[model samples]
Every structure is written in C-alpha cells, then in structure tokens.
Target chain A: MSAERYNRQIILKGFGEEAQQQLLRAKVLVIGAGGLGCPALQYLAAAGIGHIGLVDDDTISLSNLHRQILFTTADIGKLKVEVAAKRLQEMNTQIGIIRHPIRLQKNNILDILSRYDYILDGTDNFESRYLINDACALLNKPLIFAAVSGFEGQLAVFNTPDHLTPSTNYRDLFPIPPDKGEVANCAENGVLGVLPGILGTMAAAETIKLIAKIGQPLTNKILSYNLLTQEQYTIKISHGGGYTLPKTVDEFLNMDYQDTSEGPQGYAEIDASELVKLQQLESTILIDVRERHEVPILDKQIFTQVPMSEFGAFMSKEFYQKHVVLICQHGIRSVAAAEAMQEKYGDAKKIYSLKGGIVKWRDHFLKP
Target chain B: MKIELISFGKISEFINNQNIEVDGIADTDTFKQYLENQFPALKSMKYKLALNKNIVQENTEITNNAIIAIMPPFSGG
Candidate 1:
C-alpha cells in the first residue's frame, strides 16, 4: 500500500504505524450483500483492511438500488457478492476481496467462518443471525451485529474478546426468534433509504475500531438508533454466565431450529393459494379467529367467527372430518391458535393455519 | 412505585404509546406478564426488556422509579 493513500488515519493522535499495520493484517467476513453490507464493505475496503470476505447469493434487483449504494442501474441483474467484490477491489487495490456467491447455510458456514479473524452480521433473518452467532461463539471470534427496520437501526458487538469485563451474544439479547409474521420484513413494512446506510457505516466503524484498536467498541451492549425521532439508546447486556452453545460442528448440523416433537410446525401451515384450493372441498372449513370488531371483517356467511379466545370451547372430534383452517389478524396468531388446537385434538384433525391470515387474504383476494 | 416504559421499532407500533407510566409492577417478569396481558397482540412478538438502560434476563427484579424499554429484533438489513 502507498503511504499517501493511508496517511489521513495514520496521522491521528493514538493511531499510527502500529494500528495501520493491524488494519492491514485483519481479515473480516461479512454475511449478506444487501442494504447493510454495501456501506460496511465499502468503508472496510477503503480503510485498507487486508482481507475481506463477502457472502451473499442474492441478485441485485431494481428495488434494491435505492438503498444498496454499491451498484448503479446497469448492475441490477448481477450477483451481489460479485458486484460488491469488484467494486471494493476497484476502491482499494491493496485489500483482498473474496466473494462467496452462495447462501450461508449450516453446512458451509463453519468452514467459511473459521477462516476469518472477525465476523460482521448483516443478515436479514433471525435463523441466520442465530446460526452465525453460535458459529462465532464456538470459534471464539468476535462479531459486529447490525440490523435496520423502518426508520430505526440497531448495532451491537457480541462474543467480544475474553479480556473484556463481560461478553454477551445475540441469544442473550433475543432469547428466541420472533414467531413468523409477528415481525414484518422491509418488503412488507418498508424502510427509509438511509437507515441501513447509517447503520452499516456504523458497523464498518466498529469493524475498523476492532481491527485498528481505536476507540471503545460496542461490546456487551446494544445501541438502538431511530432515524425518525433522531433518538438513541444504549443498554448494557450482562453475561448470562455461560450456557451450553453447540460445541461441535455435527451438533450444530443436527440442530433442529424449526419446532419440537410433533415435527416442523410449518408443515401444518398453508399459504393463501393453498387455502383457496382447500376451500373448494366440501369438507374444508375456514374459521376466522379475529375478533368481530376487527376491521375489514370477513363475510359471516362464508366463514365461521370463532375468536381465538373462544377457540378452545369450539373444539370437537367432528372437526377432524374436515380440513380446518385458522385465520387471524395476521398469520402469527393463527399459528398459535393452530398449535393450541393441535395440542388439544392431536393428529386426528387435518388442522392448518392460514399463512398470512386475513391480512394476506385482504391484500390478495379482497382489496382493490 | 411508578416506572416509565418505552418501546421501540415494530414493538412500538404494536404498543402505540412511546412512553407509559405504571404502578404496582414488582419486577421485570411481572412487568412482562402485565404487558402481555394488557396487549394480547404482543404475546407472539419477540422482545427484550431493559430496566434503566440494562437488558435483564427473565425474572430479574425491577427497582422502583426505573425506565423500562421493550425492544424487538430489527432484522431489516
């Protein structure tokens, strides 16, 4: 690397040749090449991090261009990892950019993650987040976590250095995943174009700080920032003292993240189109679990009104003869209702929860 | 004792109010039970409770006149 290219950060008070050397030797693996990864990768590359890995299998769609700043209009159909790598390489020829153009699944995460000195999570789902956290903990690698939704963003440093006072991981923050449909994705809820940019840049700053050993990193704590109100909150996370994390790769491989004994909970769930198919059968019954007062009420004649609170009282063996579908305000409650019904009735009934409930139905079947 | 409760992100949308004052809530666990009972819609959503700017594990006690916050995972990025 040229001296002129790195002089600005090197001349800073405490950071000089020693920190610059550390940054040049540090290796980071960033998962997800969408909104958050773009800005993080750009900054890390520009900061002259010696080796960086980019992982994402998604293609750049036109919708992503508004928030994903790495690519232009012409790069829409390209793979995110490839495009990001090329751009990062062009930005800093001194840094090494490795592209993994595949999804981060349990099968390959261990091998790929072990190679990096640090991991930065820009993933968009809970499953991936948890998986990455476990892998990082098992490997004793520090992770920089960032997430954005709507007008808000959150950043945290998890599984920090052993020398730190006390360290915490993601599970300590969110004990479990939110039930499906309980939380909406950016696709469903929408987000401010700049939210991820701000958060991702913060993520990059944390990474640079971790490598360069500059200021205090956000380890053992979480910082939530809301762009709308311009408010920020930081909360300390205490070590839950140590618990059993997946110790071996095989244990992680055999891990069943879906559901318990009765098998995958999602198996008993059906999408909107499937509900339409089952509706044609005479034995199929659609039960609306939403309260009567809820808006855009379903037609009373076509569906039975059995609010979830009263769902237990209406159960019977005869319901087993038909394909019973539970519907609620959104898909989440219906699944909960279906699980309760399944517990009471066992497998005798062909019970199904409407995947998105009336909200999806209204969007697809009813609303103009 | 009175405590102020705050919620953020989608959890805030479900909660509606940015801040609320409550009395007679004993600890973090009781406060959570109160929240779930009051807003049945929150039963399924995942969230963390922070008492006075500290994230507490389940059943941790809440001191009087503290600020409690409800936060869910912001998984958008």
Candidate 2:
C-alpha cells in the first residue's frame, strides 16, 4: 500500500505515518535550481511532496554542472526550468508541479507564491534573498533558506505571519552589507564538489521538517555548517536591531534598503571611483572583496582581494578600513559582502563595492 | 585634499570636461552633500557613494581622510 512509499522516513519515532502524510500533502515552492536548489528539489520531489513548484530563470552553463546535479552534459544550453521540470516530473509523477521558467522578480512572485505553503530559498546573492524574504514576510508565508560560502553554510526560516514568533531574516543575520572586496563567492572562490551537496541536502531536510511539522525547524536558529571540519553550530538571532524591514516590493527593489550599523553612517555608502587618483593615494585601502579565482582581478597595487565568506573570520578591527572597494562575479555578492562586513565591522568610511563589479572593470579598462 | 571621481563601462556625456568641486566642504561632510555641490544632475541620478572603498548614504559626514567615490546602485547579477 502507500506505507511502502515512505517506509523508512515513517519509521522515525516522531515522524511516523502522520508526518509522511503531511509531507505528501504539503505544497512547497523551491526557487532557484543552481547549486543549492539542485539537491533541495531532488529530495522533496522524491519524498512525494503533494505539490511542488520549481521556479528559475537561467540556462544550463558548463560552469553549473560542477554542483547542479539535475542536468546532464547533453542538457547544456537548455532552459533550467525546462530541464529541471522534466527531471522533477520524472522523480515523482504522482506529485503536482507548477513550473515557473521566468526569473523570480517581485511582480511575479506574489501570485506564484500565494498558493504555496512553504518556500525554499537556494538563491546565491542577496537581492533575491531580500526579495524572497520581504515578499514572504508580507504574505505571512513560511520560508526555508540555505546559503553556503566556501566552507560555511547558513540555514534559517522566516515566518512573519506567526504572531508569537516574528521571524529573523538575512538582514537580521547581517544587519549591514560588507564593503566591496571584503568577501568571496563560490563563483570566484573555488567550492569543493561536496560543499553544495552538503548544504543543499541540509536545505532539503529543513524543507521537509517544516512541511511535516517534525521535531524542530531551523525557524529561529541560524545553523552554520563548516564542511572543512564537518562541524555545525547554531546561533539564535536577537530581535529589535533598529532595522526596519522594507514595506513594499518596490522599496525592496529600489536598492535603498540598507543595513548600516558598521559604517560611520551605517549602511550609507559612496562610490570608490569618485575619489580622484590623488585621493586614492592619500588615505585609502582599496580592497577587492571578490574570490581569487575570479579571472582578471583588479590591477591596482593599492587594492587587496579578500573573499567575503572568509571576511567574518578576518577583520577583527573596526569598519571602514582603508576605503575598501568590494567586487565579485556580479554585484549581488558584493552588496551582501558590504552589508555583512558593515554589520560586523560597525563603523568607518571608504568602503564601497564597485557598482557593477569586475565585469564592469573588464569592460572599462580591458575591453576590446 | 579634494575628492576625485571616475567611471567605467558606459560613460555619461556629463562626465567629460567637468572639473567639479565644492569649496568649504571638509572631508567630514556626508557624500550626499558632496553630490549636491559638485554634480547637481547626479543628485537625482540615484547613485550610491563611498569613502575609501565602501558604499555610503547621502547624509554621511565627510572626513578629511575618507576617499570618496560616487556610483550608481547595483543592478547586475
């Protein structure tokens, strides 16, 4: 009968038939199918989650195959949604899937998310993470989030609708963004083959735990996993950090939503390029907050490259050390890097990520 | 000490031949004020500012030692 479908999971003391059935009936939406989303979607669909929504707006890149396991070599150049949907459909034909092939923008997210009960965030950068958090916050939906950097991975859930437990978001975790050149990303810093595998599996675990109402959710806790040592630790987020979450999607998208506890002015930032050549020479440390693997790194001898993930472990001093210039694959990680460093460093100036990142640099200085 | 500015990628026409400076503005003035005095068009350009190398808001005070750089909000992924 149906008992055989979930025989193993149902054997758990607390997660018996009822929990399995709960998972079978739950509707979960997994946004992003890259590194983190790949594994998260696999387990949920395999577990026969009643209805699943797979959303993404990307194509298969030769670069993605290292961690994105859903696609094969022949699947290259195909739409991610098309390929991912095909794979999920095969995983569990009995389950329902609502495929969204478009990028997860604020406009389309609400309607798509209104019907789902649980949301999983496997996105890499901060913009999507913030948009997802704000949208779910206002909608009062339960969200499971997981992000990994080098050896570190973080997981949490935000349920703003729950009156008793106001959720903590990425903003709450790192109140201010890091300056440019303060952090690194998997794209630039080489991620071990199993890093995303380890993290994505954790995300899948959290999704099911939330759906099945199991023993405990990573709801109020921030779980950090270090693959280098196989050590996992959890930090409880405190409330009331004076950060006012954005009220509307526009507010979130306007790029004005800032976390500024670290800067002398907090999240307030300036363009590093505006400082004239003489100014840069006078008093500033132009640190590049990108991973070393990013090709054609910035050429200025004045600039230093420090990956964002490792920034937390370094920088034991105050913020605004030497007018840092953070950069990354694009600008998303740099913004997150800025906020993370800003929140942690807590005060100084001369820290700004390149507005468009090194790609802009490549186009400007070295472009053909 | 004066704050100098430069840009890459796509350059706006306003960038050329403009030697803009605001007098009586110390390094301690917030970058937003610097924009108000130097590039009036940039005031509404919706750009972000930074000293040394970090992004800063409009009201941040200018510091003599700060290396101010003005740029736009990040949109690329």
Candidate 3:
C-alpha cells in the first residue's frame, strides 16, 4: 500500500499505519448504487479499502442526478454499477473495485455476500433490506445499514456484537414488513439531495470504524437524523420476539422477501405493441384503471373501464379471461392494479401491466 | 401520568415531532392503541416504540414524563 496516498489518515493520533493496514485488507460489499450507495462507496474507496464490491441492477436516469453524484448527465441510460465502479476506481486507483450489475435476490444474495468480509446495505426497498439483513445475520458478517426518507435519515450497524448484547438485526426493530403501499419510498415522497449524502457518509464512517477498531461503532444501536430540525438521536436496539428468522439455508431460500413497493411481483409489464398482439388472442381482457374523468378515452368495445376507486367491487366478480392486462395514465396505478389482480388470481390467470401507461401509447389507443 | 412522545421518519407525518402529553396509557400496548385512535393514520403504519431511548420488545410500564420515540423504517436509500 502507498503511504503517500493515505498520509492524512495514517498520521492521525488514533489511526496509525496499523489501522490503515486494516482498511487495506478489508473487503466490503455495498448494495444499491443509488443515493445512499453512491456516497458510501465514494468515501469507502477514498479511505483506501482494498476490495470493494458494488451491486446494482438499475440504469442511471435524469431524475437521479441530484442525489446520485457518481453519474454525470452524459452517463444517463448507463448501468449504475458500471458507472459507479468506474468513478470509484478513478477516485482511488490503488484499491480494487468489483461491479456486480445485478439485483439481489434470495438465490444470488448468499453467494455474493459470502465473498465480502463486511456488508453495507444502502438499498431503497424493504425487500432488499430484509434479505440482506437475514443473509448477513446467517453468515455472521458485520452490516452497515443506511436509509433516507424525505428530510430524515437512519444509520445503524447490525449483526456485530457489542459489550451488552450478542447482536441485533433490523428485524429487532420492525418484526415484519408492512403491507404493500402502506409506506412510501423516496420516489413517492421526494427527498432533498443532501439527505442521503449525510446518511451515506455516516454509513461509511461506521464501516471504517468497525474495520479499524477505532472508537465504539454503532453496534446494537440505531441513529436517526432529521435535516429539517438538525436534530439527531440514537436508540438502543434489543432482540425482539414474534419474528421468525430462517435458521437454515433451505429455510432462507424458502422465505418470501416480497418486493412490496416496486411493482407487481409475479406479473409481466408489456408495451403497447404487446397489448395489440394480445388483443388478437381469445379470452384476453384489457382493463383501464384510470378514473372516469381522466384523459383520452379508448374504444368502449375493446377497452373495459374499471376505475381504481371502485376496484374493490370489481375484484369480487370473477372473469374467465386467461390474460388480464391493466392500463393507467402514467403506468404507476396500473402496477398497483396488477398487484391486486396477482393477489386475487395467483397462478390461475396471467396478469400484465401496460408499461409507460396510456399516455405514452395514446396514438395506439386513439387509432380506430 | 404524562409521557413525552417523539417521532421520526414517516411516523413523523402522523405524529408531530415534539413532546406530547399522553395520559392514562399505563403500558406500551395501551399507548399504541391510544395513538392509533388519536391518529387514525397510525393504524396502517408500522413502527417501533422506544421508551426513554430503549426499544421496547414487550409491553412495558410507562412511567410519568418518560420519553417515547416512534420510529418507522424508511425504505428510501
């Protein structure tokens, strides 16, 4: 390792060459290269972490520029892990940056997490948070957790033993995941650019402290910060009962970490052309989930209006169609409708949502 | 008996982020029910209650003037 690159941290009173060496030998994997992951990865790489693995399946979009500082405007449409790895590598060439451009599923999570000594969870959804937490607990890996919503953020270190307790995972706090749509994410509730920045940086700090054996890390404790009031508080977490944690690998695999907020779990999102093609098939039904007063109307003969306001009543009636396609104005509500249909039909019928919604396919709907 | 209540994250939307004077709630279980009735929105939300900065795993007695924090899990990155 180059002493010249890390001279500042090496010369610190508590952090000497020995601590720097610990950082150099550390292997940390960060999930989700969005707001929290971006900042955490940057600082972790800059601190001269020897090996860093980044996992993300999303592509950079224009809307992510404000908080996801790793990507540039020109880098839009590029894969997030690709761009983030490139930028982090540029920040510190001495360290190794590994990019896993894939989403974390139950099957793939264990294999990927086993390679890293420490796991940092910066994912944006409940599905990933619970999955990573369980895997880290099962593998006995120290986890640095960070999340943000609106003007507030949370930071915690999990699965690492402290003086008073064995260890505490996220489930110690919230035993079970909330129902779908009960809680809103950053996309639904907007956040300031600096909220995740502060939380992500703190997550990196906790990781570094854990690696270097510096001052006490946030083990068995969770910190909450409010940007609006500039006030923060830390609460002690204890082992909570009433939650079932998978004990074995088979149990973990069998556990369902449902994707609650993103979209319909077990359905397909098709485009306008695919919708047209399905119209030719027998026993195919197209549903418009928009409100009665909204937007351009489609042909009544082909389209069936089932407004979301009265969807509960519509769901009680049985339909014999084999293929059910749901559509909305912006594609957001259609996903919600698809989720409901998936819950009702299960594997008995095929469910699909119109990608980009009717607004994007106005011409196709308006024609004829 | 009175208790001080604080909220964070999405739970803050339902409960104001200040010390609230709660009365007649002897335990965490009853306090939770009281909160749900007071703010009907809290019924659907999931959160953890910390009494005096310690997360309560089970129903614990609420002392007078004890600080209670309601924290909701944030899914955003």
TM-score of each: 0.75, 0.57, 0.81
Interface RMSD of 2: 10.9
Question: What does DockQ give for each predicted structure?
Answer: 0.54, 0.02, 0.80
Reference contacts recovered by each candidate, as fractions? 0.86, 0.00, 0.97
Per-model tally of clashing residue pairs: 0, 68, 0
Question: Which is the winner by lDDT between candidate 1 and candidate 2?
Answer: 1
Q: Which ranges of candidate 1 are over 4 A from the true structure?
A: A162-164, A185-187, A241-244, A257-368, B16-21
Task: Write one digit per residue (lDDT tens) for candidate 1, span A1-368.
Answer: 67679999889898998888998899999999878999999999998899999998766766688889999988865788888999999989998999999767778889999899989999877677878888898888999999987889999999884364566788888766666546763234576678999999999999998888778889888999989888999998876633457888778887655421112232266667678788888887888888778877777887888987777788743453457788886677777777776666655567788754665456655754
Best by TM-score: 3
Give the alpha carbon lDDT tens digit for every residue of A188-298 in model 3. 478898899999999999999999999989999999999988998999999999889888899999999863234314666676777888899898999999999987977
Better of 2 and 3 by DockQ: 3
Residue pairs with colliding backbones in model 1 are: none
Chain B TM-scores, listed for every candidate in order, come to: 0.83, 0.53, 0.88
- Winner on DockQ (1 vs 3): 3
Better of 2 and 3 by TM-score: 3
